[model samples]
Target: MTKNDEKYLIEYINLKRHEYLNDLQVLLGYAQLGKMDKIFEYIQKVIDKCNDERTVFNSDMDSIMKYIKNKIEDK
Candidate 1:
Protein backbone atom coordinates (compact mmCIF):
# COMPACT_ATOMS: atom_id res chain seq x y z
CA MET A 1 0.00 0.00 0.00
CA THR A 2 0.99 3.54 -0.59
CA LYS A 3 2.18 5.71 2.30
CA ASN A 4 -1.00 7.75 2.11
CA ASP A 5 -3.13 4.64 2.30
CA GLU A 6 -1.12 3.38 5.25
CA LYS A 7 -1.53 6.68 7.00
CA TYR A 8 -5.28 6.60 6.51
CA LEU A 9 -5.49 3.06 7.82
CA ILE A 10 -3.49 4.04 10.89
CA GLU A 11 -5.78 6.96 11.56
CA TYR A 12 -8.85 4.80 11.19
CA ILE A 13 -7.48 2.17 13.53
CA ASN A 14 -6.59 4.81 16.12
CA LEU A 15 -10.08 6.25 15.98
CA LYS A 16 -11.66 2.83 16.39
CA ARG A 17 -9.31 2.05 19.27
CA HIS A 18 -10.36 5.24 21.04
CA GLU A 19 -14.00 4.37 20.55
CA TYR A 20 -13.44 0.92 22.02
CA LEU A 21 -11.66 2.45 25.01
CA ASN A 22 -14.61 4.76 25.55
CA ASP A 23 -16.92 1.77 25.55
CA LEU A 24 -14.71 0.06 28.13
CA GLN A 25 -14.80 3.15 30.29
CA VAL A 26 -18.56 3.17 30.15
CA LEU A 27 -18.60 -0.50 31.07
CA LEU A 28 -16.40 0.25 34.07
CA GLY A 29 -18.75 3.00 35.12
CA TYR A 30 -21.67 0.64 34.94
CA ALA A 31 -19.77 -1.94 36.95
CA GLN A 32 -18.90 0.61 39.61
CA LEU A 33 -22.57 1.53 39.82
CA GLY A 34 -23.38 -2.11 40.53
CA LYS A 35 -25.22 -2.44 37.26
CA MET A 36 -24.21 -5.98 36.52
CA ASP A 37 -26.84 -6.45 33.85
CA LYS A 38 -25.82 -3.27 32.11
CA ILE A 39 -22.19 -4.29 32.24
CA PHE A 40 -22.94 -7.63 30.62
CA GLU A 41 -25.16 -6.04 28.02
CA TYR A 42 -22.60 -3.41 27.14
CA ILE A 43 -19.78 -5.91 26.89
CA GLN A 44 -21.87 -8.16 24.70
CA LYS A 45 -22.58 -5.27 22.43
CA VAL A 46 -18.87 -4.55 22.16
CA ILE A 47 -18.20 -8.15 21.33
CA ASP A 48 -20.93 -8.16 18.73
CA LYS A 49 -19.58 -5.07 17.07
CA CYS A 50 -16.08 -6.46 17.02
CA ASN A 51 -17.33 -9.66 15.46
CA ASP A 52 -19.28 -7.79 12.85
CA GLU A 53 -16.45 -5.45 11.95
CA ARG A 54 -13.74 -8.11 12.16
CA THR A 55 -11.44 -5.40 13.44
CA VAL A 56 -7.74 -5.89 14.06
CA PHE A 57 -8.29 -5.51 17.78
CA ASN A 58 -10.64 -8.44 18.24
CA SER A 59 -8.13 -10.15 20.51
CA ASP A 60 -7.68 -7.00 22.52
CA MET A 61 -11.42 -6.70 22.86
CA ASP A 62 -11.65 -10.27 24.07
CA SER A 63 -8.90 -9.69 26.61
CA ILE A 64 -10.52 -6.55 27.94
CA MET A 65 -13.90 -8.18 28.17
CA LYS A 66 -12.42 -11.11 30.05
CA TYR A 67 -10.73 -8.72 32.45
CA ILE A 68 -13.99 -6.92 33.04
CA LYS A 69 -15.80 -10.18 33.65
CA ASN A 70 -13.20 -11.22 36.18
CA LYS A 71 -13.45 -7.88 37.93
CA ILE A 72 -17.21 -8.20 38.13
CA GLU A 73 -16.95 -11.70 39.51
CA ASP A 74 -14.42 -10.57 42.11
CA LYS A 75 -16.79 -7.95 43.42
Candidate 2:
Protein backbone atom coordinates (compact mmCIF):
# COMPACT_ATOMS: atom_id res chain seq x y z
CA MET A 1 0.00 0.00 0.00
CA THR A 2 1.05 3.58 -0.56
CA LYS A 3 1.89 5.89 2.32
CA ASN A 4 -1.30 7.90 1.78
CA ASP A 5 -3.40 4.75 1.79
CA GLU A 6 -1.87 3.66 5.06
CA LYS A 7 -2.40 7.07 6.55
CA TYR A 8 -6.02 7.10 5.52
CA LEU A 9 -6.52 3.62 6.94
CA ILE A 10 -5.07 4.72 10.27
CA GLU A 11 -7.30 7.75 10.32
CA TYR A 12 -10.36 5.64 9.63
CA ILE A 13 -9.49 3.18 12.37
CA ASN A 14 -8.82 5.98 14.81
CA LEU A 15 -12.18 7.55 14.07
CA LYS A 16 -13.98 4.28 14.68
CA ARG A 17 -11.97 3.68 17.86
CA HIS A 18 -12.80 7.14 19.10
CA GLU A 19 -16.50 6.38 18.68
CA TYR A 20 -16.15 3.16 20.66
CA LEU A 21 -14.17 4.97 23.32
CA ASN A 22 -16.99 7.46 23.70
CA ASP A 23 -19.39 4.59 24.10
CA LEU A 24 -17.17 3.07 26.76
CA GLN A 25 -16.95 6.36 28.62
CA VAL A 26 -20.72 6.57 28.71
CA LEU A 27 -20.96 2.98 29.89
CA LEU A 28 -18.39 3.66 32.56
CA GLY A 29 -20.36 6.66 33.80
CA TYR A 30 -23.52 4.54 33.93
CA ALA A 31 -21.70 1.85 35.85
CA GLN A 32 -20.34 4.35 38.33
CA LEU A 33 -23.85 5.64 38.87
CA GLY A 34 -25.20 2.09 39.20
CA LYS A 35 -27.64 2.57 36.33
CA MET A 36 -27.94 -0.99 35.11
CA ASP A 37 -31.10 -0.37 33.13
CA LYS A 38 -29.56 2.53 31.22
CA ILE A 39 -26.48 0.47 30.56
CA PHE A 40 -28.58 -2.34 29.15
CA GLU A 41 -30.55 0.00 26.93
CA TYR A 42 -27.42 1.68 25.71
CA ILE A 43 -25.81 -1.63 24.85
CA GLN A 44 -28.90 -2.72 22.98
CA LYS A 45 -28.86 0.46 20.96
CA VAL A 46 -25.25 -0.05 20.05
CA ILE A 47 -26.00 -3.61 18.91
CA ASP A 48 -28.92 -2.45 16.79
CA LYS A 49 -26.81 0.21 15.12
CA CYS A 50 -24.10 -2.33 14.40
CA ASN A 51 -26.61 -4.62 12.79
CA ASP A 52 -27.93 -1.76 10.68
CA GLU A 53 -24.42 -0.89 9.58
CA ARG A 54 -23.80 -4.46 8.47
CA THR A 55 -27.03 -4.59 6.57
CA VAL A 56 -26.58 -1.26 4.88
CA PHE A 57 -22.91 -1.67 3.97
CA ASN A 58 -22.87 -5.38 3.12
CA SER A 59 -19.12 -5.33 2.96
CA ASP A 60 -16.29 -7.56 4.02
CA MET A 61 -13.05 -6.18 5.39
CA ASP A 62 -11.26 -5.72 2.06
CA SER A 63 -14.13 -4.14 0.14
CA ILE A 64 -15.25 -2.01 3.05
CA MET A 65 -11.69 -0.77 3.37
CA LYS A 66 -11.47 0.06 -0.32
CA TYR A 67 -14.66 2.03 0.03
CA ILE A 68 -13.25 3.90 2.99
CA LYS A 69 -10.07 4.66 1.10
CA ASN A 70 -12.01 5.99 -1.86
CA LYS A 71 -14.12 8.15 0.45
CA ILE A 72 -11.11 9.53 2.26
CA GLU A 73 -9.40 10.28 -1.01
CA ASP A 74 -12.51 11.96 -2.40
CA LYS A 75 -12.57 14.34 0.53
Q: Backbone clashes per model, in order?
A: 0, 0
Which residue pairs clash within candidate 2? Answer: none
Candidate 1 accuracy as TM-score: 0.66
Error in Å for residue 30 of model 1: 0.1
Candidate 2 RMSD computed on C-alpha atoms after optimal superposition onto the true structure: 3.8
| lDDT for each residue of candidate 2 in 1-75, tens digit (9 for 90 to 100) | 777768878887776687789999999999999999999999999899778667646967667667667656665
Tell how far residue 42 is off in model 1, in angstroms: 0.5
Off by over 4 Å in 1: 55-75
For candidate 1, the per-residue lDDT at 34 reads 100
Error of 1 at 23 (Å): 1.3
Tens-digit per-residue lDDT, 1-75, candidate 1: 556545655666566677878998998899889999999898899889768655434558555444434434453
lDDT per model vs. reference: 0.68, 0.81
- Number of the top-ranking candidate, with TM-score as the measure: 1
TM-score of each: 0.66, 0.64
